[model samples]
Target: MKTTSYISRQVENLKPSGIRRFFDLAAQMDDVISLGVGEPDFVTPWNFIEQSFHALEQGYTSYTENAGMIELREEISNYLSGSFQLDYDPNEQLVVTVGASQAIDLALRTVVEPGDEVIVVEPSFVAYVPIVSLAGGTPVTIQTKAEDDFKLKPEQVKEAITPKTKAIMLCNPNNPTGTFLNKEELQQLAKVIEKNDLLVLSDEIYAELTYDDNYTSFPSIEKMKERTILISGFSKAFAMTGWRLGYAAGPADIIAAMVKIHQYTMMCAPTMAQHAALEAMKNGRQSVQEMTESYKQRRNFIVSSLNEIGLSCPNPGGAFYAFPSIKETGLSSAEFAEQLLQEEQVAVVPGEVFGSGGEGYVRCSYATSIKQLDEAMERMKRFVEKRL
Candidate 1:
């Protein structure tokens, strides 16, 4: 008997994430120093972890509401309001998710229909394109320029619009580039979104880690709030990536649709994680501040060190990653990463994994300790001198 080939067309056509490929290679090598993954190197605050155990001791391990525990939603609502001055009714406009990853997936699934176009700014987190495609939307990438610090320009957004365009995905305080969208920048893009009446999915996982001015939220734009789905989580800011807890806030109709999808897809986010996140939100500002400061120091160190070695990397204004141009080395981003890993045992991500705008650069995350960073810098210096 012969077995028939079986797989969904969507699953068959999907490409694995480029970042994951490099991570797998790095993981198998001994003495390799990785500055690849975007997660914070800090541990979750003691208070939050203790609260999770306390909840378990109290037998609060059952399933939560599909949206999440009401108390957690309330805490998130208050946190957003107090922190970003964005108003969201917890009861009507929020749904807890496994992570910002799941929230992004659910938001696209809820809003995009087959063949609809979803505009993604390039040099973004790798998850957006596949997630949009899995949700049956076409992923249309809009390349942002380094001269603009990788910020999305209004003209670019306007040019990407089409009758079939259903939504625009904004990754402010962006991952690979560490570029942030300010109020003025957001307002300019908002005008195009409002004019086209398109939906916005704002992934703000690194909002609290900004080094420059205060981070702006999409909901803060009065015109765009009604159609925007704001996705954030405790992962990056609270160092709770393993906890898999996040939430989305938006208009009632949008949130309701996402909740329905969440109900069928995941039922609910982890109960203990939700409980722990509530505690974090109520009392984790200081932990966030400490981590942000540490990242700032690392950021300054790495940017300066890279420049000293003849690689020009602009000072990142937000997030913990620094994207440095590798043009002088005469290698593509992938070749440079591979050669550095083999020669110096230092691992960094190739920027092209993030999309077209990242070709001549590589992403170096500053989330590691100063000791590790110093060592990595030395290795990087040797590698650059040898190559250049």
Candidate 2:
């Protein structure tokens, strides 16, 4: 008897995350120095962790409200108002999610109809395209140029719009490239969006990590708030990735739809995480400042070292990555990264993983310690010297 083909076409067609391939490869090699991961290397703040443990010890492990614990939601509302001058009625406009990843997934699932177009900026986090695709939307990639420091220009956004365009996915202080979209730049896109009547899926998970400029929120622009779904989490800023706590704020109707999806799909975010996040909202600012300062130092060191080694890296204004052009090395980004990992035992992500505009570049994360960064830089220097 012949066996049936079990895999769904969607699952078969989906590309595995390019970022994970290098991680799997590096795991087998001894002495591999990985600058490939985008996560903060810092441990979660002690007070936050302790709070979480205390909650669990007190048997506060039941499921939370579908919208999350009321106290946590209130804290999130206040935090957003204080940080970005954006306000949302937490009781009506918020849904607690498993992570920012889940928040993005829920947003797309909530709004996108089949064959809808979702505009994603290229050289972005790898998940955006796949998430849109899985939600039955076509992922329309808009390539942002390195010469513009990878900012998504208004003209490009305008050209990508179509009647089928359901939403625009904006990742400010973007991953891989670390390019930030300030208020002035965001206003341009906001005008186009307003004109087109398109929805905005604004992923501001890295909003608090900006180095040189005040980070801007998409919903803060006049007339854009009602049309925007803001997704953020305690992960990056408060070192709470493992807590799996994130929230989305938007128009009540949209958030209500997302809450339904979240209720059925996840039931709720972990209850202990929700309580700990409330504590973090009250006390995590000092820890955030300390971690940000460390990342700033590492960012400075890696950018300078890469430039000194003949890689043309623009100093990123935010996030913990430095994207450097590797054209002078006479190798494609993938080949360069592979050869470097094999020869120098250093691992960095090739820019192509981030999509089309990312070719001929590599993304190095500075979330690790200075000592590790110093060693990685020396390894990179030796590798480039031989090639150049």
Candidate 3:
């Protein structure tokens, strides 16, 4: 049997992740500076590491309960309540997964039936559209505009809804653009969601990284608890990306269904990771605050520097990314990214990979140290000046 012929058409047709390719390229180079991958550059918090080690020493190396250990789930429930004023029952509403990535996939697979249409906001995380497709659903995109701060509009959401529409996936403190839906913005969308009787899959992995104001959890809104599935994890704020742990909280029935798929496919998230997460929930707030402060500083510097150098970048309200328009340079996002990598040894992700609305922009992650960022900025400035 031919290897290529044996692969399913769906698998064959899927394009590799744009972020992964640039990250891989940077890895192969000696002096390249990357603002490509969305992960935090910080190591996992020391307390988390200490607890994980303690857990290993105690022989806590088995799989947890299918839904996750009771203690960890309770900690997650309490953390959500204390952090965002959102309430959930650990036994009925939460399931710990391998990571936020797995939580997303499990959510889609649980709700999306063959041919269902799922509304996905564009300039979003790359995984949403593909995950919907893999779950046998149609992805209908709502392309947010750069001028609008890349925030999804209520009217746009209303217009995209169809008779076949089943759900909408939201990435708050959105990736690529680093845009967030403030309370009023969420209220506007809430009206549309309630009017259409639709469900929401809220990805709040970067919830702790919001700047300018406190972040409001979608499920915290009035009457939204039943309609919203909230996904969050320790990867971003706690700098624990490699730990591969995350959890989903939502309506009991929906979460239960997701747990079924998770039970068969994943069995459970790692027990040791869950132990560390429990400790994080209890004592990691200070570590999260410190990391967020660092990212905010980097954000301010990078955004200011980019604008000073001629690129127009919106002030991202949350997350550690700045999406800058490269339209003025008359180069496509992909072209600009390619030229920057080749010419200045700076690596950035082309915005178009986030979908069509991203065509004229590129995403710059400010999660690196200020020294690296300063060097990257100098190189990027040089690249822009030469073009101008």
Candidate 4:
């Protein structure tokens, strides 16, 4: 049989991750200061790690309930309610997922049918469109503009809707750009969503990293809880990326559908990770605050530095990324990223990898230490100057 014939067209046609090629190239280089990665650089708090060790020592190594351990789920419920005013029943409205990435996949897979359309905001995380396609839905994209500070407007949401539209995917404090929506902004969009009778796959993985008090949980909007699948996790805020633990909470029926699919594929999130996340919910506030402060400082510095270097970046209100325009250099996003890497020993992700509306820019993660960021900025300035 021909290889093409044996493979599913969807799997075969799926493009390789645009971010991976940059990472692969960086890995082969020496002494490269990388701003390409999106994860928090902070080590997982020792207390949380110790708690996981305790769980393992106590022989809690077996698989958890497919939805995850009750204790962890309860903690998640309490935490979300306390922090974001999102009330969920641990038993029926929550599922401990392998990661927020898995939660996004589960949410899409649960609701997206062959002809359904998901309206995806552009310059989003790389996974959203592909996951929508894999879930058998079409992704209708709306490109947010820099002139509007990259905020998706209520009008755009209203315009994107059609009879077949099933949902809208939102990454508040969006990746690559780090643009966050305030409560009022989300409410305006919420009105449109409510009118359209559409579901919401709101990815708030970076929710805890917002620099202001304005970050609003989408499901917490009036009348939105029933139609929203709130996806989040411990990876970004708690520095628990390796734990691979996340969860989704929404209407009980939607959550049940996700859990059913999760049960077959993952069985359960890692037990030790579930235990660690329990501690994270209970006592990880200090670590999160400290890291958020550190990130704030780095965010301030990087945005200022990029502007001074003439990259013209908006001061992102949340997350650790700085998406700065490289258009002045008169090179494509890919060209600027590749040439910068070859010229200066720095690695940053080209913005084009993110989605439409990301060209002429590059995403530099400030998740690293200030010392490294200072050096990377200097290197980038030198490279950009030569190009100009």
- Taking all chains together, each candidate's TM-score versus the true structure is 0.98, 0.98, 0.98, 0.98
What is the TM-score (0 to 1) of candidate 2? 0.98
Which residues of candidate 3, in runs, are more than 4 Å off? none
The TM-score measured for candidate 1 stands at 0.98
Weakest lDDT window of 10 consecutive positions for candidate 3: 21-30
Candidate 3 C-alpha lDDT tens digits along 61-87? 988899999998999988998889988
For residues 1-388, could you state the per-residue lDDT of candidate 4 as single tens digits? 5677888899888998889898888889899999998899999999999999999999999998999999989999999999999889999999999999999999999999999999999998999999999999999999998889889999988889999999999999999899999999999999999999999999999999999666789999999999999999999999999999999999999999999999999999999999999999989999999999999999999999999999999899998899999999999999888888988979999988988699988999999999999999999989988877
Error in Å for residue 121 of model 3: 0.5
Superior by lDDT: candidate 2 or candidate 4 = 4
Backbone clashes in candidate 2 total 0
TM-score: model 3 vs. ground truth: 0.98
The better candidate by lDDT, 3 or 4, is 4
Which ten residues in a row are the worst by lDDT in model 4?
Answer: 1-10
Candidate 2 lDDT over 1-388, as tens digits, reads: 5444677789779999887897788888999888987789988888888898999999998988898998889989999999999999989998888989999999999999898999999989999999999999999999999888999998999999888998999998899899988889999889999999999999999899998888889999999999999999988888888888888999999999999998888899989888889889999999999999989888989999999999999989888899999999999999999999999999999999999899999999998989999999999999999989
Give the per-residue lDDT digits (tens) of candidate 1, residues 1-388: 5433476788879998888888888888999888986898998999999999999999998999999999999999999999999899999999999999999999999988998999999999999999999999999999999898888899999899999999999988998999988889898888889999999999999999898797789889877788899999999989999999999999999899999999998999998899789889999989999998999999999999999999999988898999999999999999999889988999999999999899999999999999999999999999999877
Query: Model 2: residues >4 Å from true position, as ranges?
Result: 1-4
- Which residue pairs does candidate 3 place in steric collision? none
